[model samples]
Every structure is written in structure tokens, then in C-alpha cells.
Target: MASQAFEEIAETFEFLDDWEDRYRHVIELGQELDALEEEFRVPATKVDGCASQVWLMPAVKGQGADAIFDFRGESDAMIVRGLVAVLQALYSGLTVREVLEVDAGAELGRLGLDEHLSSQRSNGVRSMVERIRRIAQETL
Candidate 1:
């Protein structure tokens, strides 16, 4: 089943006619995310290549085919935080194999975000995706 968070975000994006409005909605989504604990924000969990500081931690549950990976992330920048929220919506609760199978770049492009962000911001998002996919691969 699709995550309720992702569904709600996609629906909200579809309803917003303007890119500016969409950006605002994304920021709002960021605001809704809980802040990561101080200890979890350490360098070991930090994402490299992002223009802003970002930390992501993964929690795995169950075993074998029934396993699910949930993520918790935080970013210093508001927009980056929003991007983290988007990632969580799409990937959290998915199995490692399922996460590895997702075409995150294509999905971001479909959301019109790829065209709208600055190159740096886009690269930062890609870095986050790469890290998540790498973690998924390691789990497998």
C-alpha cells in the first residue's frame, strides 16, 4: 500500500497550481516533521555532498521478506528539511528491496521539483537519495 504521507503530499501538489504555492506547501510539510535528537545528528549519520547539513538514521524492523525500514532525518535548511520529509513519505516503511527499486529521481522530476530547484539544491536532494539507496543495498 502507498504511504498516507506520500498520498497526501501528491494530492496537495496536484491541487496547487503555482510553483510558488507548491514550494510553500513543501516548507509546511517540513514544519510538520519532528526534529531529530541531538545525538542522532552526529557526523556518522550526516549526509555528504549536500549544501546544507543533513542527518538521516534508519531503523529496521521484522526480518527477511517482511522487513521494513523506517527513516528519521533532519536538515538545517528549511527546503532541505522539506526534501527529507518527501523522502520519508516515499521510502519509510518500505522494505530494503522496495526502496532500492524506487526511481527517486524520476519521481522528483514528475513532481516538477527537478526543474524548479537550483542545481545545488537538486544535487543535495540527489545526495540524500543516493545515501538512502546505499543504505538499502547494505541492508540487503
Candidate 2:
């Protein structure tokens, strides 16, 4: 289900005329995410080294089925939230191999993102890819 959603998001990008509208769409999706508050503790084990606190919880139905990653993140930076949304859109539903196959850097380039990002934002993205790959490794 989530995999289909991701592909649809990619298609949405395809439909966009330019990066301006695409960024608005990205921001909108970021707003859609369930933000974790002070009272909420989704767990830190799956929280990777994000500049802002990020939570990732995944469930596996069975072999060959994709994992569903439930994410919650909070950051002062709106762009960071948008980056998380991009990660969620790309990686939420994927088999271990599929996760391994995802070219995150390439994907970022395709989105016309990352080049103008600050060092901190770049680090945050690296953290996300590391966490995701770590999860994928664990499933193996």
C-alpha cells in the first residue's frame, strides 16, 4: 500500500511543472506528518542521528512483504520537515532488498534538491539514509 503511495508521489513530481510547485507539495506532505510532541515518546532505538529528533517505527507482515515505517519528527527548520517527508515518500514501504536498491543521493538529485541544502540539512539526510539502511540490514 505504502509502496504504491510512494510511486504515486513520484508520479506527482512528474506532473509538476517546476520545482516551486513541487516544493509546495513537499511542504504540504511534511505538514501532513504526525508531529511528536514533548509528551509523546515513540522510542529512541529507531531514532537515528537527525539534527532534529526523528522517530521511525516499522512493521513487517511476512517474508517478501514490504515494511511499513511510521515516522514522527520535530524540527525548528521547515525544510528539515520537508526533507523527512521526502524520505517518507521514498522509503516508507520497501523490502530489505528494495531498500538496499534505493539510490537516495540520486533520488535527491532528481528532485533538484540537496544541492542548495546547508551542511546540517545534508547531515540530516545522511542520517536518514543510514537509519533506513540500518533497518534494512537488520531485516536480512
Candidate 3:
């Protein structure tokens, strides 16, 4: 289940005439995200498979399957940061159970991100999705 924020991005991507414009939109989205606090950037939060340094701090409210799943993330690379923002839109604010139920690749594919991104970037996205899913699963 894609969030409304993610759907808006998809809609914007559809409205853009070219990949360059869409790329810029993604970068702009990244620029809009709140900066991750330094304390949250430690080794334990770091996502290993990304080419650039990336960290995600998961936050949960309540308990068990109904807990809300939210996370804040940052990346040293601008495009990667944008990807993180995209992930935020895709997954944030869902119940932990809902987060686990999401088909991340399918939802992202609707935006045609799979075709536009480089292999390394694609792998990084997968890594991020996995991390998000793992966090949700553990919370459950």
C-alpha cells in the first residue's frame, strides 16, 4: 500500500516530460527533508550496502502489530538522499504491520524508478527497503 505522499511523487513523475526534470524533482525532494541529527548517524544506524554513507533511525509508537512505523534517514550523496526521501514517502506513517505488507518494489516501479536509476542506486534502494522492512518486522 503506497502512502499518499508516494502517490503524489508518482503523479509528479508522470507529469514531468523528461527524466532530467524528474531527476531534479527527486533532488529537490531530498533537499526538503529534515537533516538527520548527528547522534543518529552512528555505525549502528548505518546502512551498509549504499555507495554513500546512509543512516536510518526508526521510531515506533505504541506496541505490537499496531505500532506506527516511522523513520528518519540521511545520505551523504544528494541523489541518495532523494532516494531516502522517496522511501520516506513510500513507507513512513504506516502501521508496522502495514509497512511489512507493502510491496516496495512494485510501488516504486509504478514511478519507473527501476528503469531510471543506476544499478548501484537500485541496489541501494533495495538495501534501504530491506532495512525498513527489517525494522518493521522486528517491531512486530
Write one digit per residue (lDDT tens) for candidate 2, span 1-140: 23566667777878997778887887787888777565554556435566666655554444442554434455545667777777877776566677778888887766666765767668878887787777676766
Tell me, by TM-score, which candidate is best.
3
Per-residue lDDT of model 1, residues 10-73, tens digit only: 8888889999999988888889999999999998899999999999998878665457978899
lDDT of each: 0.86, 0.68, 0.92
Model 3 clashing residue pairs (backbone) = none
Candidate 3 local lDDT, 1-140, one digit each (tens): 98889999999998998989989999999999999999899999999898889999998897888998889999999999999999999988899999999999999898788999999999999999999999988997
Q: What is the full ranking by TM-score, best candidate first?
A: 3, 1, 2
lDDT leaderboard ranking: 3, 1, 2
Worst 10 residues of 3 by lDDT: 59-68
Q: Which stretches of candidate 1 lie over 4 Å from their true place?
A: none
Q: Who is ahead in lDDT, 1 or 2?
A: 1
